[model samples]
Target: MDYLQYAFFRNAVIGILIISVAAAMIGTYIITRRMVSITGGITHACFGGLGLGYYLGISPVFMAAVFAVTSSMGVEWIASRYRIREDSAIAVIWSLGMALGILFVFLTPGYVPELNGFLFGNILTIGTSDLWAFAAYTVVLVTFFALFRRTIIACAFDSDFAQVSGLPVRFINYAMTVLVAVCIVLTIRLVGIMLLLSMVTVPVLIAETWSRRFISIMLAAIVISIVSSLGGLLVATIIDVPCSAIIVLLQVALYFVARIGKDISLKRPIR
Candidate 1:
């Protein structure tokens, strides 16, 4: 309780909550569209931006965002226009981005003290700017979903049908690719690149066991993410462990618990 007096702790709590909401909403879309691998690619690509930012003495998050968005858009464009397979494109981009990051980091002078934070995350370092960014992103995501829920759903479930039905499938796909990239970049501060994919997917997986409907899963995921993130943060603080790892481990534990409950319910006789 006394730790609540610290501004950094308060900022972390707020940042986690905001990030959990936005990640759950966007993660629902990512999972529904089966773009989980693409999301992972984009997150890895951000490492290139982070390394570049460090080499250039600029904001790593901004650089990471740029790399992420570019990588996502590049994958979409290459897969749609060129003869390359989507998975191949993702693989190329993933490897290229990681290679670029390593090269940049190797070339960069000085000790690069913040590199560990970007790789593993330290939630206690979340700042006011991060909170503001998360809040703004949440607002934009909520508004987008509210305005185009049906179209987004149609595109997610069946893009061919969505295009045939004249629902701007191309536009929606591109926009969503960009949105997912941004979401990954934002969440890097919470769980770092190594564990971010799990952060986005675990809650969604748990939510899926409880509901098949998209909206219901999104809501459930939000609640689950909040609980896991907050609980992990608190436990990490008490035990003096890494917050990001604790958060991810907690989510993984909950996923197994959800899986067991789901199995038990399926085996139970109906009344």
Candidate 2:
């Protein structure tokens, strides 16, 4: 295809694959540990970083990473030290980040271009530089998953048990929180802040209908995300529609199909 000759097309493919893998891993942890809203809180918080980056004329990605990590850590600190509800902490951070972002973006002199791209996303605009950054981060994420698979699983299922077993529960939480923040920032460019949460959540939900094992769900989610995302990208190119929305829709459709399949299996007679 003529599109393949274009660097942007190649970059989009590479970027989506890397993101799918990273998101599947992070999504597993988030779902297992019930941190979906925390990740969502981090997503909204990254918008402030984008506004701050525009205000300061620096890389939006860098500022977003900072906001994400801070938001995540802040939530942890508030909930643990002050005995506040985690959801309440998330609410505070979420509002503050969005408010600060709006303030900074307004304070800047010119009309901000590329802001919408960060908000709604444009997969077609991804470049080699984006791909490289995603690749580096994915490598680190994979290494983390590989090294701490058992410990991470322990923490996810029961932090109390893990702590009592002499595992560094607190340290693992902080590390995973940092990793989750970084994943959120990197994924922002893919689906933007608006739809990014689904990219991390939907595929895992689809996988859960049929599998109960942690690694099984993660691996199945990675495959489902890749298939749906790539399929959506190709369809978007063909129809001239938004890729991210299409991708999410496809994953959601798969979720329904998986649910139906599960129901059907339950009604079948045992051999």
Candidate 3:
């Protein structure tokens, strides 16, 4: 409670709430579309942006957004345009992003800034600008979801059928991909590049074990994310532990709880 007095802690709380909503939405979509692997690819791709930004002495978050979006789109582009496999494209871009990141980092001049914070987590140091970026992205994501709920569902569930039905599947895919990339970049501030995938996914995975519907999963995921995230923050302050690890651990702990409940319910007598 006392930690709330600090502006950075307050900013972290707000960022967690805002980003959790977008994360739930995007994570649900990713899970539905079976594109979870791309989350890792995009996360790594943002490292390229971070390295580039550090090398150029610019804002790492901004460069991360650029790299995240470009690499994500690049994966889709090469796969669609050149008939390359999607996994193959992801692997190539993943490697390229890492390679570029390392190269740029190594080339940075005069005592390079420590990137471990960006690598592991930055919630404790998140600023007003980062909060604004997350808020803006959340607004855009909610609007997109609201306007095209059915279309998004159709595309997520059956892209081939959606394409056959003239539902603008390609547009939806690319649009969502870009949205996802930006979301990933914004989220890096919360849990950093290494652990962000779990922040989005572990909640959705827990929610999935509880509900089958997309909306249910999304709502449940949001709740799980908010709880685990905020709870992690507060608990970390009390125990002086890392917020990212606490958040991830809480989410994983909830998954096991959900699994236990599910197993127990299955053992009950039929109604």
Per-residue alpha-carbon lDDT of candidate 1 for residues 1-271, written as tens digits (9 for 90 to 100): 8999999999999999999998998889988988889988898899899989999989988999999999999999999999687788999999999999999999899788988888888889999988999999889989988998999999999999999888999998998888899999989888889999999999999999889999999999999999999999999999999999999899999999999998999999999
6-104: candidate 2 lDDT, tens digit per residue = 988988998999999999999999999998999889999998999999999999889999999999999989988999888999999999999999999
lDDT of 1 at 205: 91
Candidate 2: give its CA RMSD in angstroms.
1.0
In model 2, where do residues sit more than 4 Å from their true spots?
none
- State the local distance difference test value for candidate 1: 0.92
Looking at model 2, residue 111 earns an lDDT score of: 94
Clashing residue pairs found in predicted model 1: none
CA lDDT, every model vs. true structure: 0.92, 0.94, 0.91
Give per-model TM-scores: 0.98, 0.97, 0.97
Candidates sorted on TM-score, descending: 1, 2, 3
